[model samples]
Target chain A: MFEALGLMVFYENMLALNNVSLACGDNQIVGVFGANSAGKSTLMYTLSGIMEDIAKKELMAGGERITLRGSINYKGRDISHDKPSKRAKAGIILCPERRRIFPESSVLENLKIGGYLAKPAQAAETLEYVFKIFPPLTKIVRRLGGFLSGGEQQMLAIGRALMAQPKLLLLDEPLLGLSPAIQYWLAKSIKEIAEERGVAIIVAEQYARPIMPIIDYGYILENGSAVVEGDKDELMNNPDVKSAYFGA
Target chain B: MDILIYGVINSATLALMALGFTLVYGVSRLPNFAHGALYVLAGYICWLLLNRLGLPYILAIALALGLVAVVGGAMYQLILVRIRGMSISEIIASYAIGLAILEGLRWGGLKGGTFTLPAFLEGSVDIAGVSVDFQRILVVVLGALLVGLLYFFVNHTRLGLALKGMAQDERAALTLGIDSDRMAVASMALGSLSAAIAALILLPLGSIVVEAGYHVLIMAVAVCIVGGLGSWTGAILASFVIGFAQILTTAYLGAHFQVVVAILAIILTLILRPSGLFGKQKELEERV
Candidate 1:
């Protein structure tokens, strides 16, 4: 299980994420729905400890000042200050937005790279599992990552994340720029992955229609704040949540 | 006969010199201007071990290479890590380090062409009526072997694949538990080892002088620039292109025209194609 409390992130004077908190239990799929600039991706970055890296890089470059204040509890440990790689080694993997696959590497290489922390046996098993789950990837095993289509890239991204044998998978806008058909299909696959792998998943997205059915718990975020939190039925049936997030 | 035989030898030497520089730049995007200094340092260390300590030649070479790897890794971890992501600072800081090392040796009384590593073999052999020295032949053979081994390492091995991922998409690699700093350190060590190996093999052909340090830097820069910066295959091909051009110029125009050819290759590559031959990923995408 994972939990975060009093999570606040600021970029200089502007608040990017304001006291937003959420949690997910083991083998559970939690959804955070919001519009663009709603701090959804920021939350994902913070959870994965990439914000720490970005802030350090920015400070060195004399660029935007980033400040993050939060406590993330993963299992029984507090990992707020852990480096991204450390968090990854602890089995928290982020499938980042826009599918940042290794452009020059092949699909198989990308997956192999993702298994950086896994033992040889674990990596090999996960590699086969990935190709099985995302059957389309098997066809483009030798194709370059940059050459994949949006749907294919999304699959590879998730597949790559899975190669790390994640305990908690953080998916940031996996459905972005994809067709509705693939979005729903991917949403189904996400549920299947969580069920089969028994890994907790925190998926942040703008499209809630397909995502809402699979998420056991959901939080509606607006202007960097989580405005609503409830079970799937309670969130879907809320008049305000329906109007704002679902367009109903 | 001279052109063909010497061209291959010269090309292999260039490849060996540039491989470290290119590999470091490819993985960390850190243009280690200190590459030439490391090359010279390796040769100097081996010479000192052999002469001063009276160590065996093989052991001296191994120790020198190991020391060079440690120095290279320390260079990045101590200095380059701070200025990383700012390419300008990375260049200036690394160049300053390189300058200090190269000049430090000069100030320490390493001068002239008197210091030379003994060749591994005693004589030369004739191939197709052309007499080729054994040392020069070793450079070519080792160069080819190193290139092959490096290619295999980067693609097939776990660490190499991780480094490749870091080279292409660092944050993506980070989320997979491949630390950027660690990868950079590994690259610097490997790059430095390659530099040392080059110095060890090629220095036997002639004396190890301070000027050779600067010359190696120019050759490396020219090769990387002309080859299309981060592309491995491109660097090798560009090395051959520039290498043969240098040989052809030496044979016809004069020996001094060799460096001129390298500089001209850089300028021409920049003017004709701003990105080296394999610079643009979109162009490579067409092949996929």
Candidate 2:
């Protein structure tokens, strides 16, 4: 279980995330849906502790000033001030937007690299599970990550994050630029992963059609704030949610 | 036959010198100007251990290497860590450190040609009617072995895989719990170890003088630039290209032209490819 309260992020005078609070329970899939620039990625980055790293780098380079104010509680522990690597070691893994797979490395090597924090036995077992869950990865294990198709890259990204043995996995726009068929298939896989591995997942996406069916609870983000929050059936039946997200 | 054999030997020597520099730059994108200072420091440490402390050759080499690795790690943690992400500052800070070490050694009377390490095997062997000294043969053998070992280490080991991931994408690696600062320190230590190994093996061929430090740095930079900065395979291949050019220059255009060839190679690579051979040209294009 993880909870983020009153999360606020600012780039200079512009607020990227404003007073947003979200939580995920054990073995649950929480969907955060919004259009472009709705602070979905920003929320994911802040929760994953990557914003701290970005802020540090920017300060060092005398570039933009990024301010983050939030408390990320993971299983009764306050990890707001923890470094990104520490957060990851504490089992909060973020599969970033655009896949961000290691371009030059082979798929197998990319997966191995992701297993940096896992015990040897855990890594080996998870590696097998990853290939089992995403069987397409087994066929192109030797291909360079950059050369893989978008769908394959997304699968590899998810597989790679799973290799890190996350307690709470953050999927940022996992359905972006993906075909509808692949999107539906990936959504199904995500559900299975949560049910089998019992890892809580928070997927942020703009395409809500495929993801909406799988999520137990969901939040609709507009601009930088959460506009609506409810369970699956409540969201599907809401008129505004239907027109905006489902396009029905 | 002489040219062929000598060319390969020179290439291996260049590869050995540039390996550390390339590795550090590749992983952390930090151009460690202190690399040359570390090379000379290793030799000086070995000399001190051998002569003053009365240690055996193997023991002295090991101790010297260990000491340099610690120094390299400290260098990264204390200084390089602060100025990271600022390339100009990183260069200036590292270069200043290098200057202090090299000049400090010179000040401490490391100038003369009196300091020389004995070869592991003090004999020459004939290969295809060409007699090569054991030291040169050892350089080639060890160079190939080091390359193979490095490939295996990077591919099979967890630390090395983390390093590769960091090199490709720092943020992505961080998400997997690979600490960038720790990896940078590890890279610096490994780079320093490679420099020390290079010095231990190559110093046996001639006297160990402070001037050799500057020469090694220049040659390493030239090799890295021509091979493509931060590319291990590029460094090796560029070493062969520049190595044979240096040897041929020495053979035909007098020995003084050896350094000229390296400088010219750097200039030409910069003017022509800019990114050097095998560099991430697409990345540059994307940035531009």
Candidate 2 lDDT by residue in tens digits, A1-248: 79999999999989999999999999999999999999999999999999999999999999999999978899899999999999999899999987889999999999999999999999999999999999999999999987889899999999999999999999999998889999999999999999989899999999999999999999999999999999999999999999987788
Q: TM-score for model 1?
A: 0.97
Runs in model 1 with CA error above 4 Å?
B281-288
Best by DockQ: 2
How much RMSD separates candidate 1 from the native structure? Answer: 1.9
Which parts of model 2 have CA positions greater than 4 angstroms off? Answer: B283-288
**Clash pairs for candidate 1:** none
Tens digit per residue, CA lDDT, model 2, B142-243? 999998988898889999999999998898998889999999999999999999999999998998888888898999999999998888889999999999
Q: lDDT per residue, candidate 1, B145-262, as tens digits?
A: 9999999989999999989999887888888889999999999999999999999999999998888889999999999999889778889999999999988988888998989899
Clashing pairs in 2: none
Worst 10 residues of 2 chain B by lDDT: B279-288
Q: lDDT per model, in order?
A: 0.92, 0.93
